[model samples]
Target chain A: MRNRKMAALTTVPYVIWMALFVVIPLVLIVVYAFTSKAGGFTLQNFSAMGDYAKVFARSLWLALAATVICLIIGYPVAYALSKMGPSFQRTAIMLLMLPMWINFLLRTYAWMSLLENTGLINTFFDNIGLFDLINKIALSLASDPSAYQPIDHFQMINTQGAVILGMVYNYLPFMIMPIYSVIVKIDRSMIEAAQDLGADSVTVFRKVIFPLSLPGVLSGITMVFVPSVSTFILSKLLGGGMNMLLGDLIELQFMGGAYNPYVGSAISLVMMIIVMICMTVMNRFGDGEDQAVML
Target chain B: MSEKLINLENIHKDYGGKVVLDNINLYVRDKEFVTLLGPSGCGKTTTLRIIGGFETPSAGVVYFDGKKINDLPPHKRPVNTVFQRYALFTHMNVYDNIAFGLRIAKVSENVIKDRVTNMLKLINLPDYAKREVSSLSGGEQQRIAIARALVNHPRVLLLDEPLGALDLKLRKEMQRELKSIQQQVGITFVYVTHDQEEALTMSDTIVVMNKGKIQQIGTPVDIYNEPKNAFVADFIGESNILDGVMHKDRLVSFCGKNFDCLDSGFEKDETVDVVVRPEDFEIVPIEDAQLVGTVKSTIFMGVHNEIMVETEDFTWKVHSIYNAEVGDKIGLFLTPDDIHIMHKS
Candidate 1:
């Protein structure tokens, strides 16, 4: 009885913290999502999302691309990390996470400098003679005589590719950490058992390791997808306001020149519903139900 | 046996610097249930792994079916292993787990199903095909593990302490069932364990090991009765080892009493270690006995009374039907066959 009382007492601070930070803010968002400025219930805010459908479509597509790219780059890195010695694994993980210690906005701003029209990448390409090849290709593809002007540098900045690069760079560590943890926790005996039963290295991986790591892969997908789908800073700075995402549209309603909190709340609510649906679909596709509940 | 099915030639294994197996040579005949019995970290599992091709020996070669196969990976070898913890794939159900090897072999779907059904029946889990591996009991999991390995019909099956996780009753039941399964399948089995009783109960031949070396390799009776060293005598069963002197052939003296033993050829007054099993000692009267001692402790085992008898120089364990109280005098007699003599180390 005394232990129960002590436990209940210890939970008081956490309960208060959750109510103040999580519950109240969520209630306020819901109230604003469904109510007008005169404190009257209305569905106009929800109908407002139809106007920004292109932004939502573009954001989802870009986020999907970023997620796929992260999985492609992160799976091998996580597998290699799991195979390293303990001290080496620790150092590798620390290095992977070192960039996140700085301000996220500052890091996103740093990409703007590197991906600009006259940026470091174009300068490096110019040194490697890739700029000359690109110029010759453009000249050959031109139709008119005057249109055969040589290209000076590639227009890589403010493109969808630039926004995706930012998202992959910022969210890749999220992908690697979970997959690495799951791979490391896989029992060594399972691999040996597979081999002992006449499974070669490739068969063992296809039959044992890959299937076992799906839970981590699912979690990594969600981790990278959710944030990339809802990000505003990367699309604004790296995309240079040319490619407005759902987050950018929502930010415009509440904090930008639009200044409408009701529409912002409605978009936030819709994004939450979309993310929840995506997660459910992913969990159904993979055998991540056991781990999905945990997350 | 016509020829050794598996022969390990001068197998030496070293981990970083410390040697786990040193100059080990062993041979397993076809259809033999051989056990590698030793304490933990005594290289028994290492020997099993080397045969399974999980670990490469630092030196020497392994032969399977009279051909050198030292460099063959485990997947290419004609052997399967039932790991210590069962190592069942958690994501797979029992049916898929059993069918994994058949699928890898590219067996037809119909044949895979038939073999899996037979294996499930063989392990006595007909209705557990669709159940997840994690839901099964320890004994059920162990049976599935055995079934998974046996389904491949490998030439040899290696089991590394497969029953170490079970309760006593389940372990005994599994032991009998595993022995019968091995006999039924006619596959050579190389089992590693530290349990002496388990080794004696199931193995056709027992290889007693200690500190990276084989102490003795013999049948259960020979290992128990005619141990080659004190280590084997102490490890195999309860023994009352004592210091004695060999006067000449058929004559030995210990506890200030001369005893008649089986034929022995040694220098005069050569020191030897004598092993006498506790159950071998007869509770004779003091007048007709060769040696006598005072009882120190008595324990009531289920079938016999375990009494410790202390002489002036050594303490002896005597297991007899007759109970002797503490501090009581008891006389013990030994026959010539009961005395096993070895050079003192």
Candidate 2:
């Protein structure tokens, strides 16, 4: 009885913390999603959810695109690193992962120097003479000069395209690491087995490696997509107000221009639900047994 | 006799300035079972990998059925490997595992089905076609690996310790199974293993390797009875080596006995080592004894007793079915056939 009481006492803080920080917020979000500011309880939040059609579509597109790019660029680098001798692999991965140790926002700020108006790219463009100031100014002029007039000041600084670039840069290593560990763990003999069976490298990769790397790929995708869907800082800093992704809209209602607590809670609730749904879909394709077998 | 199927000429492998395989020349005759026997780090697996096209020779050529396959990738090679882990395609069922190669070669669905079914029967796992590979036991998985590799119909099958993962009983069972399978498939089988018994029991030709070099290559009988050097003799079976000096053309003195052996061509009074098998000596009466020693201990080993005889010159063990009490004075009889002279390293 004493041991049980001690165990309960030790767990008391965590239980209370979970109830206070997790359960209450979740319950509040669900409650806010159903109720509205004007009345008691209704599907007003669901009705207002339609108001985010453009944001939803654009956010989904950019998130998916970033995730895809992450996988494409990260998988090979990870595989290459894994193939190196153990000592070399250890140092190389350490170097590759060093950038991740710093603050994520600082890295984003560094990319700002690269993508900023009259930044490195613009300076190159100035020398080349094909483009103008900020990444946004060049973008607005190229896409639609009439609706999107190029601002004299830091234009294109905050835009959907810039957000995607940030997302890709940020999530690429995450995509690579999981995929790399899996790829490295995959028995080299399986690839040989495939080939001895008369499979060219392409066929072996397709039939053996790609299918085996599915768990890592799916999880990598989930890692990138889920985070990108919720990420607002990049969109806020890089997307020049012409585009408003779901993250930006959530930021607006929660902490910025619009102080709509009900809408903010509703968006958070929806984002969590969507993330759960995506994870479930990924896990369904990534059968637990096959995933265990892959590594 | 089947023609030579695969030939490796002066193959050498160096990794980062460290030589893993040094000037390895070998040949695999058609439908023959060749085993590369070596201790760990002796480059046996590396040699097998070179044949499988998983690794390239630093300075040599591999000819598969008279075609130079030095630059060919593993998939393009006319060889499949039953990896030590039996690297079965876990994502695929046993049927798909067998059919993977056929599908890769663009065989029709109907043909693939037939071939896979036939292979499943060959490995004696027809009903297991639908079972996921991870669900299978170690022995079953090993058969699946063989089935998967064999279904491709390659000219050579490389088995790198395929039964190494199995228990001792299964290892013995699989050795027989592997030999029969090789005979049935009629493709050259290149197996790699550290176990002398497995190689001695299964292979037609055993290539003994040590320190990344081929020490000796011969038939199992040749390897065991007449090992070329100390390493080979010691590695193949239990051997008692005694330092002795040649007294005459056919006689050598060791363990306080002047034994007549067929071995000759040693300089008069030259120092040499004599290899004696424990089972070769027999217990005899004291009057007819060729060598005398006091029994130190008697170890009962089910069918036979291992008696350790301590003598003035050397300690020797003799296995006999006759009961001998511990610490008894025994006269050991060594026939001319038991004592073979070996080169001291």
Candidate 3:
């Protein structure tokens, strides 16, 4: 007990850092959301709920879409990784995380380059006689004189697909980490128990594995969904400002179009509330006594 | 009563570079209780798991009745195992855990209830039907495990140290309950345990194994009284094995003295271990005895006195009603029938 007290005293620096960096910032955000620059203490900041309503709806939907995509792509990969040997698991996860180590903007630019009209994909097709085939057949009526149109014909440079692609790529490891840890810790004997009870492979997965991995699913959803909602760079770089995503509008408020701290803080507060509500709903479904026991 | 229910033929198991079960073969007669008894890592559990279809033998075949079950999965087999930890589904209540097999068999809800109720009564746990298995006691969990296995009416029951985690008193109590349950079910039981006393008490036929090979398979009486070698003799019970040689019919020479033994098969001058139960030795007057010794020590047991006597060549242990103090001179007499002579294999 005395030693524990000494250890508690030793954590003073970390406790102060957490209060200053984390708690104070969150409290300040909530305080600033209601206080407006006009009356200084009016709910006028929330009065124009109409202006930010579209942003809230769009960002919430996009985050949900990205989380769903991550679930679809990440779950099977995590399950496959969990069944491998230790060396294979380590190397495979390292390779999956290799993209994250590169600069995030650089990787986003790489995707932009690939999807662009005059990018490597288009150049390869021109070199491979695709353009010649069109010209000879006179299907070239629609073809332009330029061999390649850089970001002119392809709309990928400023699209929602670009945002989703960026989100899935950036947040894939988050989806995998929780799910992989949970799946790997699943007892072999529980699956064996299901099998010995005459459940076939598909039935076993439906009855045992899926329901058992709900905690990881909920955690991964929170991890990917919360971050993707407010991401501005992906929409700015890939969407090319053509589709004004919620994140782009929020960035515009802080960076260029209007220096309205109150509106931006209100949007941020609403996003935080939506993420918390989703988390609470998830917790309600899988709280105290509902979890599947692997043992 | 079983008509050769399960048969295993020359099964081999290798893990990485080391072999765990080597060329194993055995058979389970219908309704007969057989125990695989051995020290740790002797491959008894491996053989049980193979029969349970949790493992495929590297070589040789496993047969259930007459059908080859070499490639069959565990769920496809007509066998159920009571694991050491019971391995009861903690997610379920007692009723659900028992009803799992029936549910998998796709029995109707009414039939599932009836079958689970019957099992609960059989295991003397009728009141525990709605209780979460995690809330049950160790002994209760054990009974629930037995009930779960029995509800399926499997052709054979595989028990891997079912009483291993219980306390001494509970373990002994469960041993009796398990034996009675086997008799009531009348199913072939293949039990695996390293506990010698559990094997001696519960098993009708015990297969003793060592170093991945079967040492001997025999009735408890045969295994105890007529052990095949030194390993079986030492493993089964108290064996006072003296290095001796058979000299002639019903006679052996040990401790630099010729004494009568209970062996007849060996030729004269064959090396053998002379085993005698402590109770078999009688202390007589030194004048008319075949062997004489001075009392080395005396231990007071409730029923009998354990006296150790030091002879000229060896120290002899005996359980006697007579009390003799240390340094007292006495004669040790053994009848030909009391001495058990086993060959050194």
Specify the highest-lDDT model's number.
1
Give every collision pair in model 2: A136-A156, A157-A238, A158-A238, A158-A239, A158-A240, A159-A238, A159-A239, A159-A240, A195-B75
Give every collision pair in model 3. A158-A239, B2-B30
- In model 3, the runs with Cα more than 4 Å from the true position are A129-154, A242-250, A288-295, B279-333
What CAPRI-style quality would you assign to candidate 3? acceptable
Instruction: Put down candidate 1 lDDT per residue, A123-149, tens digits, no spaces.
Output: 888889997897777777778747577
When just chain B is superposed on the true chain B, each candidate scores a TM-score of: 0.98, 0.94, 0.93
Return whichever of 1 and 3 wins on lDDT.
1
Question: How many backbone clashes are present in model 2?
Answer: 9
lDDT of 3 by residue, A1-295 (tens): 9999999999999999999999998888788888878638757767766876766677777788999999999999988889899999999989988988899989999988987778776677777877667665554454764564332233455678888888898998889888888888877767776676777788777777876777787778878987888788887787776556666776776787787777777777776787678778877776746442221
Q: Report the lDDT tens digits of candidate 2 across residue range B1-345.
A: 137688889988999999999988888898888999999999999999888878888999888788888988777777788888888898898888888888887899999989888888888888988998888999999999898888889878889888888999988877888888888878888999999999999999999999888899999999999988878987998887889878877899886668899888888888888888888888899889888888889999998898888888788888889898878898888888888887677
lDDT of 1: 0.91
State the weakest 10-residue window (summed lDDT) of model 2 chain A: A148-157
Q: Give TM-scores for every candidate, taking all chains together and pairing residue i with residue i.
A: 0.97, 0.89, 0.89
Taken over the whole model, the C-alpha lDDT of each candidate is 0.91, 0.84, 0.83
DockQ computed for model 1 against the true two-chain complex using alpha carbons: 0.89
Q: What's the best-to-worst order under lDDT?
A: 1, 2, 3
lDDT of 1 by residue, B1-345 (tens): 247999998999998999999999999999999999999999999999999999999999899988999999999999999999999999999999999998999999999999999988888898999999988999999999999999999999999999999999999999999998998889999999999999999999999988899888999888988999888999999998889999998899988888889957788889999889999999999998777899999999989999999987789899999979999998889999989888886
Winner by DockQ: 1
Error of 3 at A20 (Å): 1.3
A24: Cα error in model 3, Å: 1.6
In candidate 1, which residue pairs get closer than 3 Å at backbone N, Cα or C atoms, i.e. clash? none
